[model samples]
Every structure is written in structure tokens, then in C-alpha cells.
Target chain A: MNHLLNIVRKELKELMTIGSFVSVLIMMFVFMGAGSMMGDQGESITSPSDIGFINGDGGLWADRTEEFLISIYVDTYGISEEEARGFVKVMDIPLDDGAAIVEGMRSLGLDAAIAVGPGYSSNLDNGIRAVISEYYIFTNPGLLGSAGSSITSLMIGEISDRISQALVSEIADPDLTPFLLSPIKGTDAHTYIDGELHSGVRPLDISMGVMNQTLMVPVVIMMVIMMIGSIVISSMGNEKENKTLETLLTMPVGRTVIVTGKILSAAIMGLVYGIMYMVGMMFYSKGMTDIGGLGGSSPADLGLALGPVDWLIVGTMVFLAIFCALGLCMILGAFAKNYKAAQTMTVPISVLAIIPMLLNMFASWGSLPTAIQIPLFIIPFTHPMMVMQNLMFGNTAVVLAGMAYLALFAMLTIFITVKVYKSDILLTGIGQTKLAKAFAGKRIR
Target chain B: MDALTVEDVHKVYGDREAVKGIDFSVRTGEIFGLIGPNGAGKTSTLRMMSTLLRITSGRITVCGHDVATESDEVRKIISYLPEDAGAYKDLTGRAYLKFMAGFFADGAEAEKMVAYGMEMADLGDRIDSKVDTYSKGMMRRLLIARAIMPAPKVAIMDEVTSGLDVINAFEIRKIIRKISEQGVTVIISSHNMFEVDMLCDRVAMINDGRTVLCGTPGELKERFNASNLEEVFVKAVKG
Candidate 1:
């Protein structure tokens, strides 16, 4: 029992390194950042949405429709009457042009606009259906950007019900008004995406469906990259810690062959892991869709489905990304002196994989600012995560470009890894690096 | 012709030099020893000769192939066993031997090498057990077998019997003598002067990265006016 305790104590001391501690801390920060972003989006989902109301029909029913819109803010959001009145802005503008209505909504800082057409009140009073148009201005494209459109659609549905209830209560014959209770008819929603108007489609539904399909790609990519990267690094660490590296290095093999062999083995393992995760994700995504009622619009209907050739391109991109990750890990592993240090070495690769995953999840690549885009593009892992979405949207040029960049990046990493394998750094570690020397306040001779 | 030649070799790590202009030669089938205190650059010298490290200056050749320019050729003819060498813990002793033998030969010849390694290790039925389960002495025997199993032209071993009991150390010494008799040139480094005297045909005493003495055990003792190699090492290193 004492010998067992002694061995346990020794193992604990060996495993608990400062590098491991720092890596955990870094992971904590990444989770916190993601949580903060999600919290912001959550706020957007629950809060009262701002919308512009244009009354083209100068009648009592149009006035009542506008009032019902404000009532949504008061009852649902728990806001005071005065604040609710201000939440729905009544615009005295002509609703003849669709583009002008969208422009008016944007200028008023509203994501959606409701335009009541001419004869709306008269038609409804006569028991004929009154048509109302909902204009959704999509300034951003992602899961986060779709929140406003979702809220606006929910609010519009509630107002239509409230106006119908008012009409039914005032009817002389209650039995006659039963069929006409739902007099308000909403035309197909108009969505302005990237300044181009897409008629008869809701941006929210399109984004939600696209999110469900492409979401798993980035998540699976991140997991596979981190897992395989850790394996390659730990393999090098084990070789060094076991004192087997010296013997292996002295063997009759070229350094390139050694580096390539390690990468290929790790890449094969990564592909196996990726396939398993993808199969699991497929079931998981199906479960989520069923439980959350997230059926939304089908991507095929929105012209965003991937064909056979697109899938092949995505597969190639994924393969290249894995190759790049293995090569990068091989270079980092060269600096690891032991297994403990190798665990820490995985943190940088983790950060790289995670940054792209989070960004791709929250924002569309085309919608991101160039400042963020350039740096994200430079990370080799980002290409695979973005490829599925790009291919879905028929951005074949962008997908091909990403594939080319990934191929270039993979080759560059392999070249560097081979050099590191040939160098003494594999044995001597960071002690000989100029960065280490600089930190030690020593000049290189 | 010399089996190995290290001509004025130097090893530098950034601002510090580990081995400074050390020169030596070994004849075919000779069991040469590099004797030094801790951190005396003995391992660095041997590592450079085995093509595991780059020479900052000068040249080392194994069977007339330059270690720097012809490292691939040098690796083909040499094997290195570090002081604290370990086999893959997950592999059985026989599996580990087979893995190393695969690198040097294939098919029936590789099978023959594995058989020879099993004989050299002499672990009996224990050779089928995982390496991690082996005792320190047993592990040392297995590693020594792995180093010589390839039948390379030169074998470099650092501290071959380090951290072993009296019986284990003596057995390993006998194995070293047997290997040398098989016409394999061996280079070894150790702090145990008595073991060096018994196992080595020639010895070099190094201190502060320089070769301070080089001769047979008897010649070194006589030159330093000492009774044994230990006394000679102390006299030579101190002087």
C-alpha cells in the first residue's frame, strides 16, 4: 500500500506541470468569450424588437393595427405604455416602393418594416382579406443576425391575431364573423440580403436551416484537429521522454521520411476520428431539429444545397486541413522536451482551431470585416470550416481559392517540419532557440 | 584502417561549447572507452560520432563516410544506445526486438536477427512480457541486445551497465566482451574506471571537453604512476 501511494504521488507530480495549468487557463478564457457572445444573442432573442410601421390605409383598422403592434411591446416585454408606444415607430411615408420602405426601416434603425396597403381597412370591414407586407432588412448574415427577423415575424403574427379579435368582438352576428375573424393576410416576406431583395423568403428561416446543416462541419473540424494534433505532439513527447528518440534518430532513415511517416499516421487517425464524429453529429443534429422545432426552410428550396462535386471539394479541403494540422503539430512537437511540455504545446493549435470555429459559427465569412477576415484566412484550419458554407451558397470560386490556400499552407508546414526534424532542436529543445535566449537576456554569438 | 575517426570535433550550444576540438581514432574490433566525470561532454562526442548531433567544427567518419556530409551512410553502419535508453513500454521484449531488426533487414534475415537478439538478452520466457514490466537489469539486457542486434559496423553505448546490481553489471560486462570478440567496433562512455579497465581494450580520459589521456588500461596506469585505471583517471584529470 505504501509503494502504491508512493507511485501515485510521483505520477501526480509529473503530470501537473505549469504548461498544463496554463493550457487549462487558456481554454477557460475561450469558453468565457463564447459564453459572452451567446449571452448577447440571447438578449436579442428575448427583448422587444424595433420595427417601422407605415400606414398607407387611412382608416380605423390601420390605426388599430398600429396600436396592436405597440401593445406587443407592453404586454410581452413588460414595458410601460409610453415606452411601448415609442418602440413601434409610425412612419407617415408612402409605401408604393419596396426599396424605399426598406431604406426607411434602415434609417430608423429598425430591422423590419410593416406596410399596410390601400383598402386594407375597407376590405377587412367588407369581409374581404386585407394584405399586409413585412419587409426584413438583413444587414448581417449568420445565426446572430437572424435573431431580429425571428422576433419581428413573431410580433407580426401576434398583431394580426389581436386585430382579428377586435373585429370579431364588434360584429353584429357572431356566427357570421367566425369565418372572417382572420381577415389580415400577410404576403410572402421580402428579405433584402446583401442589398439584393429576395422575395417570398424569410431570412430567419433560411439562416436557421443553413445553420443546422453547416454547424456540425466546423465543430467536427475543430475536434478532429485538436485530437490529432495532440496525438502527434504526444507521440514526439513520448519518444523523447522514453529516451527512444536518440536511437530512432540515429537509424538509417531520411529526416523527411521520419516526419512524413509521423504525419501520415496521425492524419489517418484524424480521418477515422472525423468519420466517427460526423456520424454521431448527424444523429445529434437530427435530434436537435426534432426537439427544437427548428425545421425552418429547406436549404434546397433556398438554392443552397451542396451537390456531389461540392461535397468532393469539401472533402479535399478537409483532407488538406488535417494534413496542415499534423504538420504544424510536428513542428511544435520538435520543441517539446518531455510529455508535460508537449501537452502545453497543443494549446496554440487549439487556439487556432477554436478561433475559426467560433467566428464561422457566429458570423458569415462574407459579412466579416476585412481586418478579421485576413487573419482568419491565414489560419489553415479556417478553410475547411468555411468550405461547406461557401459551397452551399454556390461560391465555387471562394471554395476553390480556399482549397488552393490550404494546399499551399499544408506544403509549407510540411517543409518546415522536415527542417525541424533534421535540426538538433528535436533533441536539444527550446534551450537553443533565439527566443529562449532573448528571454534569458543573453545575446546570441 | 581505422574503424572510426573523429578529427578535432567541436560541439557548441549557442554561446557555450560542450565539446571543444576532441580528436580520436579506433581500430576495427576495438572496445574503446571514454571516461569522464559528469557533464564532461563524453555523450556529446559519442552523439556526434553516431550522427545524432551536428559537429560545430571538424569532421567524424565511420568506415570512411563523413558524419556531416554522409550522415545517411553513417547511420546505416552505426547504432547508438543512450545511458537511459528505453524501449516502447507497450511492446513486448520480443516485439521491440523485431521492430528494430526490421529496420536493418527483412524477411528471414530479420527473423534470424530477432532470434540472435533473444539469445543475447537471455531473458528466457520473460522476453514475451511487456518491457514496462521488466526489472531494471532485465531492461538493460534487452537494450544492449537491441543495439547489437543490427550487426552494424560501429556501436556507440553510453554507460552500458549504469544503475545495475553487482551480478547484473558483471553479466553485462561479459556480454560486452563477447560482442567485441565478434569483430564489432564498440565505443562506450562510463564513469566506472574498473569496468572500463576490464571491458575496454583502449581508454580515453576526458575533462572539460578535452581528451587529457588516451592509451590502454595498463599503459595509462603506468604513465600516471598509478596502480589502477581509477587512480590514473584521478591523477590525469586532476593534473
Candidate 2:
């Protein structure tokens, strides 16, 4: 134990002396800044709020539909017609004058505005007269036609007919009205499909949040494992390359002890990186609030929201991630002929560890079928983010399952890697073991 | 009793026999030098003797401990310094020494041992500095100091002075002699013929996985009618 500790101490010292220990942290910080600014944040539409409302009106549904149309814009979509008119920014604005709006629609190749005309509700009530209109002054006839349905069609029939009746009572010959509305029938009929303010599934927000923490664990774990594996394998390889390993082997210290000592040293270095990364991330989370669109919660809120179950999930994933990384790195390290080769080999393993993280971070929930989820859940990396998601939305079973899976994988991976490391001490260059080669390929590219 | 012994040790690398059943022993309190040309199986023999490599056949014992079965015992009894020594660059020299000291925690009086090691290396205040800052000579000194500081029953050095300047080499030789005087057995492998001639009590010449000659330098010299150990080696190899 003392001998192993000595090796670890030595490895840690070497890691500190070289600056590679701090490099990943810097990379993560830069990745965070750049990633946040990449999509929808950097170069986007100038106006923060430009809700486009396409008007499609049938001639018979005109007056009542116009009044209903104006009311639905205010009440259903939760945006007042008054606010919509005033909200248009004229600076480089495309929709100011009627001609420009028309030209803009033409350039976009839209045949007509998307409109819910009057009397559309009455037709639906009759079960025969569908609200139909002749779309013109446009090139692309398909534009806005597919997306537009009478507000009456959107709501339940009972509510739709009542709203149509109310709109009809307000005007005579509603057929000539320009703007039309299909009455919002139900109490909860407000469904904003394309509106920006609605909080549906913001993948970017979840991804940024999940990735911030998710990518962090694996990156740190892989780096730590690589750190240790590098030290052990490189130290041995250095000995062999310089013909010194042969000498050490001849010493009274025997192959096992010497190998153990070297491995211990590597493990120790990896642990240091792990600790450094964890602590660094802990510090990093303090500043995470500076970047928005990453789940509108503070790190503190995230921490408070997570319970013991969440920790188990995180812990399991972290353990498994480290286990897999350490084992694979050790195997890679053993095959490397020199320090440079060992380091080169680490790049691929690092990337492989991160693949799971990327998959977990960016994949939309319910999008992956159960068949995919079963295997994906088996990968320890999926657990942390999965658990994070569960915790955020108050899901218990997923958190527990993710934790269990992580634990299983972590134990299995670490055990196997250790076995490979022990067997490959004297073996130089890439060996003939199919499993090792396959894993190496996964790590390298 | 022999301080170190290798009995009919053979090391086979796949099908190639690196060390083909070689045998030798070193006495207590003496400097034993194993000299050989490049790829002469010197390293293989030294490795088997040191317990770093397993013997394909036969046995090796250090201070009465078997190399294979009693490896931990062998480790405790001897310190082996390979020709290419590396220091942990991440640690301060003092911390590194302390860490090495901790290896023999129960037996090693760490504080005193580390201090003596630092003082012997002549590092002064630089002992507190990280080893990455050390020069080649400094690193060599530190490694030598680390190996000898534990005061093992046997010391195995592989090309210990290869990178040293004359001054540092002389200084290390002085330290080796000092260590030997204290009854520690010293076994070394080197290409420097003069060093072997000057320091070894007995010399073994190896070539192509076998020991061609083994005797006191003077005995070999007298037998070969040569002036020095180098000429003796030349004559032995040639014949």
C-alpha cells in the first residue's frame, strides 16, 4: 500500500510540474462560451419579437370572421392586435407598408396570408360548408395554406359553433369582411406552436444545461483516467524504450510489485485529475449563471433541486465513467511504445468517452425509442444527464435505473481494464487481443 | 552468504532466448561489474538478478529471498537503479524523496533518510524545487541518492554514470565506494571499461546471451597477458 502510495505521489508531482493537468479545464471553459453563442444567439433575426400572423379569409365569412380574427389574435395567442401593430420595428423592417408586406409575401413565394375567416364556424356547425377562399397575388400557392386552418376547426365543435354564432350576431353579411376569426371555444384552447415565448421543449436550453454538467464529468473522468494510464504506461514504455524497464525488471522488486507500483502511480495521478476536475467544475458552476439559455435555473437551484436519488444517479455515472476511462487508458498505455504513442492513443479514448455524453446531452426525450433507450441506458454516461432530467421534472424511477446502470458498468469496466493492464505489462506495441484492438480503435478515432 | 545470486537463470522472449541459462553470484561488501557489448544479454541477466523479470528457467535469490516466490522480500533487500533513471517531475525534490522514503514506512526513518539523501545529492535549497527544474546531473544525483538512501543489503545499478560529467561521475563513484565500505553489496552494468577496471572487485564479461569470462580484473588481465580490464575483455571476446 505504501509502495503504491509512493508511486501515486510521484505521479501527482509529475502531473503538477507539467501543465497538461490544467489544459482540459481551459478547453471546457472556451467550449462553454463558444457553444452558447453558436446557434440562435449570435446572428439571428434583428427584432426580438416579430410574431408573423398570416390571414386567410373566405368571402362569405368576412365581417364576423374579421371581428373574431382580431379577438383570437389578442385572446388565443395571448398577443393584443394593438401591441402587434405597435411592435413592428421600421428600421430595416420588411413588413411596414401594405405594398412591402405584399412584396415580402411575394418574395417568400406565399400565395396568401394564413387566415381563419368568419362564417367558418357556422359552416363547421352545418357539417358541410367548409371555410374556403381564393388565394391570389402570390407565386407559391402552397405557402401558408397548409398551416392555416379556421380557428373553429382548431377548437371543439360545440365551442366553435357558439363562437361563430356570437361573431355572426355582431355583423350582417359577414361574407365581405377582410379579417376573420374562428372563435376560440375551449377554456384551454391556447396552443402556441411557433410562438417564441412558449416554454415547450427547448433543446438548446436542456442541452446546454445537461452538457455543462454532463460533458464535464466524462471529460474530467477520461482526462483523469488518461492521466494515470499515461503515467503508468509511459513510465513503463519510457523504461522499455530507453532499455531501463529491463533493468528495473531485473531488480529485487519483481515484475508484479514494480508493475503494481507503476500502476498505482498512474491511478494516483488520474485520481488527482479527477479531484481537480470535480473541484474545478464545482467552482465553474458558480459562474454558470453568466451564460443564459442553459435552463433558466441557477447552479444553486439545480443543486437544491437534486435529492439523494439524484446524487446516486450522478455518483454511479461518475464512477462508471471513471472506471471505463481508467481501464481503457491503461490498456492503451500498455500498448504504446513510448510516451508520445501513449499520449496519441489517449486522444481517441477521450473522444469515445465523450461520445456517450454528446448522445445523452443532445438527444430529445421520448425521441429515442425503448429499444434504443435500453442499450443507451446501459452506457453509464447516459445516467447523469438522464438523472438530471428526471430530477428536474420530478421523475424517480429513471434516476434510480440510471444510477443502477452506471454502477454496473463502472464496476465491470474498471475490473476488466485492471485485468488487461496486469496482463500487458511486458507486452510491447499493440498486441493481438481482438478486444483490446477494438477498444483501441474506438478510443483512437 | 552471497549478497546476490543468479542460478542457471534463463529469460526467453517468445522464441528468442535473451539470457540462456547464465549463472553468477556476488559476495558481500564488494563491487561486482557485469560488462558486455551491446545486445550481450547483460541487461537480461541483470533483470533476472534484480527481480524485475521472471526467469524462464532456474532461480535467483537476493539476500536469501527467492526472486519469484519471495519478490516482496527481494524488493526489501535490494535497490536497483536502471541505466535510464527518471524522476517524477511533478513532485518537489524534497517531496519526491519523502515519497520514496514512505515506501519502507515501518523500517525507514523517513525524515532523517530524506535529509541525508538531499544533503548527499548536494541539492541545497534546490531540494525544495520541483525535479522538472533539475539538470541531468541533478536528476542523476537525486536518483542515486534515492536508491542508496534506503541503505539496502544490495544495490543493482545499470549504467549509473552514463550521462554524468567526469566530476559528477567521480562524485557518484565516491558515493558508491562509501556505500560499499558500509558492507552493502554493489552490482552494476556498464560499458565504461575504465570504470569497471577502477571500481569492480570482480568482473563478468557477457556476449550474446552468455557469460564468456568471469574473474577478478587482475586475474583475467594476467591470464590474457593484457594491461587493463578493457584489453582483457577484447582478448576474451576475440578468443
Candidate 3:
């Protein structure tokens, strides 16, 4: 056990000491840092649609809400106080009815407006439903309007909850009211897929998953490819190049143990690089959303829920896929004569792994034409993402297919690596079959 | 009685026979040498004795244990250092020795062995630096130290001082002679006939995968009527 552990430790140490690992680490952190820096500017939202309020009820509750809105303009818009001063205006019109106030807001060219009714305070006192009328035109539909609506809804929800709490305390006990939240029922809001939408599957949360695909996934997948490929290949190639493989083979340790130890070392390195890249991407992604990229939605609208089973399925598939990649690299790396050759050998495989992941960012499986979708379905690399995306939305068929393909691919690659390592050609670099070598005393190295 | 034996041992790769039925034996603590030009099967023979390659036929044994059937036992008692062997560039010389020692010994024994090996290397403070920072001669010193670190019954060293300068080669040969005097049976294959003629208690000349001549350097030199082992090697190839 110590021997195996020592081997793993040595390989890992050597890899980390190599200059490339540090380079990749710096690269991830730098890009992420740049993204996070830009995220600051995006976080400070400047509302494109100004809010207009008509205070008609003159009731304590309605007027209190108005006061709260006025006081929190900077907080709601996420802007500097000086910049938020010009954000909203209280339109003073002679008309007190909700409809008249809304019409007046339109005439005044306000993008969004709210009118409180006379029955609002009375209805609350009577424990009846209180309704506030709203009118709005969303001019900047993409980012500004989305963010404005998100913040507006959140604020409205908070005010309603407070009112409901007051009513519940009246019906029950005032002492317990502040400590208790009011109970209410509401339907969940999800994104709408143009067609083939699942009934209950929440729309893919925009900032976390969708933004992650575009902003984080490509960089992460590339990092995974380079990090794992370079580590695995260079390890074998170094042993072969320096003539240590033969020495190590002669040791009492079994070949499988050596291979497993090397694999474990490389896997650990890949995970480290993956984690670093992920952290960097998280900062970068936040920055992107902050800068009006895949962001703009309030935190509540961005809430994502993935069940335990879905997480399990995605985790298993990703592990299998990465394992398959590692195995493929090991096999190809055996044929290489040097570190450069080893890295070059993995290029095609890296390309295969990367292209699909990048493409998945721009288009969904259903949206792409049948010809394109079929190719995506066939790729082993495509399965992990599909499994992750579909499992949440209850696509059992896609998940099972992806699972089977990944398992088979992983097994096949492992078998190939084992066969190559067991062969004498692994030492000699002979691209020859035993049958072709009628005069085969030649060494590969 | 022989501490090491090779009885008509042969290694065939496909249809190519690299070592064709070579037979020899070394008594306990004797320094045996294999002298041959390129492709003369000298390294192949050392590799076979060291249990690095499978023998196609016949038998090989060290201290009466078969190299084929009891390879693990043979490996424990033997250390093989191939020509131009490279150390892990990232590891310090001291750490490298300790790592090798860990394979055969545990705990205090491993540390003690590593300490002894470091002493043998004679690298001093530079042993703490990574091998990549070491000079070519330093690398050779480290390899030689690692080979004998296990205190093996048999040390198979192939062309140990192959590419060293005069000073480094002399230093390495001096170490080999010192280790031999301490009762470690040594099998060395080298192209340096003078070094072999001086260090080896016995020598064998191989050509075309077969041993054409065998005996001590003086005996072979007298038989060939040559003034030096290099002349003996030249005459053996021609004759």
C-alpha cells in the first residue's frame, strides 16, 4: 500500500512542479479575475424603465408602501444614491381612480406605473383580498426590462407579506405576528420553451445554467482537456523518454498497480485544475451577469432546484466521461516518443471532447435540426451534459441512453489502455504486430 | 560454488535471437564483466540476468533461485542499473534515494538505507537540490548510488560509466571496485575494455549473440598474445 501511495505521490509532485501546471492555474484565475472585475459594473443596475406611482387610496398601508419605495430607489436599482435620484417620479394628477391614474401615467410616457385603490386598506381590515392595479410598457426587453421586473416583483411580494402578517396577527395574536410569516399560495414561474415544453420542469435557470454554459462551460471543458491530457501524456512520455519505464517494470510491483497509481495521480491533478478553473469561471460568470450578459434577473428569479437523483445522474455521467478521456489519453500516450508527441496525440481527442460542449452552449438539442442533433447524440462527450440538462426536466430516455454510452465508452478505453501497456511495443515504440516482426529483436526505445 | 549462473540462456524476440545460448557463472563476490561491441548482446545478457526480460530457454539463477520462476525473490536480492538511466528530474537526489529505499524496506530501515545510499553518492549538500539542476557526472553518481543502495546479493550494472569524462569515469570505477571489495557480486557490461580489464575478476567476449571467448583479462590477453584487453577484443572480433 505504501509503495502504491509513494508512486502516486511522486507522479503528482512531479506534475505540479512542472511549469505548465502553474501556468494553467494562473490563466484560470486571471480570466476569472477579469470577469469578476467587470461583474462589479453590471451589479450596479441603471433602470431603463422608470417607475411611476399614483397614490389614490391615501390609506396608511398604501402610503407606507410608497414611502418605502421612495426610500429604497438606490437599493432597488443597485445604483449610487446620486444616480438613483432621477429614477422614479410621483405623478400628481387630479384623477384618483386607478384607471385614470394608469392613463395619466401612459400620457406622461412613464414606462411602468402603479395605482392604489380606495378599498385596499378596508379590504385588509375586513380580511378580504386587496388588489393594486398596475400598467407598464417594457421598452428595453432584453436586460433592463427583465431586471426591473424581477426587482419590482420582489419588492411587491415583500410588501404583501407584511400586510398579510398584519392581518393574520389581527385574526390571531399581535404578539406572535412579527415572529410569524403569513401563509400564502402561489404558482411557480418558469422559463417558456418555444415548443416541446415539459409541464412541470422549470425553465432552465438563466444565470446559473444558461450563463454557465456560454461563459463557464467552454473555458472549463478546454481546461479539463489540456490539464488532464498534458498530465497523463507527459507522465508516460517522460518515463519512456528517460528510459525509466523499463527500470520501473523490472521492479517487483505489478504492471496494473503502476498503471493505476499513475492514473490516480493524473486524476488528482485534473480535479485540481478543474476546481481552480471552476472557481475562476464562477467569478467570471458573475461578472458577465453583472455586466448585463446572461444576468439581469433578481436572485429569486434565478433560483434553481435540481433534485438529488438528478445530481446523482449528472455526477456519475461526468465521472465516467472524464475517466474515459483519461484512459484514451493513456493509450495514445503510449505510442508517443516524447512529451511533445504525447501532447500532440491527444489533440484530436481534445477536439472531439471540446466541440460538442461548446456547441451545446449556443443551441439546445431540440432546437437544432435533426441532422445536427443525431451527431450530438452519438458523441460520448455529449452525454454528460445531456444527462445533466434532461434529468432535471424529466427526460428519462435521454438520460438512460447517455448513461449506457458513457459506460461502454469508458470500458472500451480502459481495455485499450490495458492492452497497450501490456504489449512489448510500449517499451520499444514499434508500430508493428508480432506477426509482422519475423526478425524482431529490435527495442522500441 | 557459483553465486550466479546462466546455463545456455537464450532470448528470442520473434524470429530474431538476441542472446543465443550464452553460458557463464560467477562465484560469490566475484566481479564478472561482459565485453562486446554494439549489438553483441552484452546489455541483453545483463538484462536477462537482472530479470528485466524473459529468457526464451535454459536457466538463470542467482544464489540458487531461478530468475524465471522466482522473479520476485530474484528482484529482491538484485539491483539492475541500465546504461544512461535517468532519474526523475523533479526529485532531489536525497528524496530519490529514499523513494527507492521505500520499495524494499520500511520505516527505520528505509531511512537507514537512504542515509547509507546518500553517503555512498558523496553528493553532500547538493543532494538536496533537484536532479535537473545536477551536472551529467552528478547524475551518474546518483544512479550508481541507487543501484547498490539495496545492498543486493547481485548488482547488474550495464555500461555504468558509458558517457562520463575521464575524471567522472575514474570516480565511478573507483566506487565499483570499492563495492566489489565489500562482497557484492557484480556483473558489468561495458565497451571500455581498459576499465573492464582493470575492474573485472573475469571477462567474456560476445559476438553475434554468442560468447566467442571467456576467461580473466590476463588469461584472455595471453591467449590472444595481446598487450592489452582492447587488442584482445579486436583480435576476438577478427578471428
Give per-residue CA lDDT, model 3, range A1-445, as digits (tens). Answer: 6999999877776554323444455556544643553353244334434667666667776776575555566655576655554656677754334345545656777645555657666655554556554444432122222344455455556656756655665677555453334322222222323222122222223323443433354456556866787778877888888877767766666667777777767767766787788798888877776775345333233333456876687668767767777887888788777775576566556655665665554444444447656767777777775554454345678789889988898788777777776565576554344643432223222
Best by lDDT: 1
What ranges in model 1 sit over 4 Å off? A1-119, A126-131, A135-140, A154-201, A432-434, A437-445
Return the clash pairs for model 1, or none: none
Stretches of candidate 2 off by over 4 Å are A1-306, A364-379, A390-445, B106-108
Residues B75-185 of candidate 3: C-alpha lDDT, one tens digit per residue: 888888888888898999999998788788999998889988998899999999999999889998998898888898888899988888999999998988888899999
Ranking by DockQ: 1, 3, 2
Q: What is the TM-score of chain A alone in each candidate?
A: 0.77, 0.45, 0.50
Q: How accurate is candidate 1 locally (lDDT)?
A: 0.85
Best model per DockQ? 1
Candidate 1 lDDT over B66-168, as tens digits, reads: 9999999999999899988999999999999999998889999999999999999999999999999999999999999999998988989999889999999
Stretch of 10 with least lDDT, candidate 3 chain B: B46-55
Residues A95-144, model 1: lDDT tens digits: 76777777787788877888788898998788777877888876536777
TM-score of candidate 2 on Cα atoms, chains taken together: 0.63
Q: lDDT of all predictions, in order shown?
A: 0.85, 0.59, 0.69
**Better model by TM-score, 2 or 3?**
3
Candidate 3 ranges with C-alpha deviation above 4 Å: A1-218, A293-304, A363-380, A404-419, A431-445, B1-3, B7-21, B54-59, B64-69
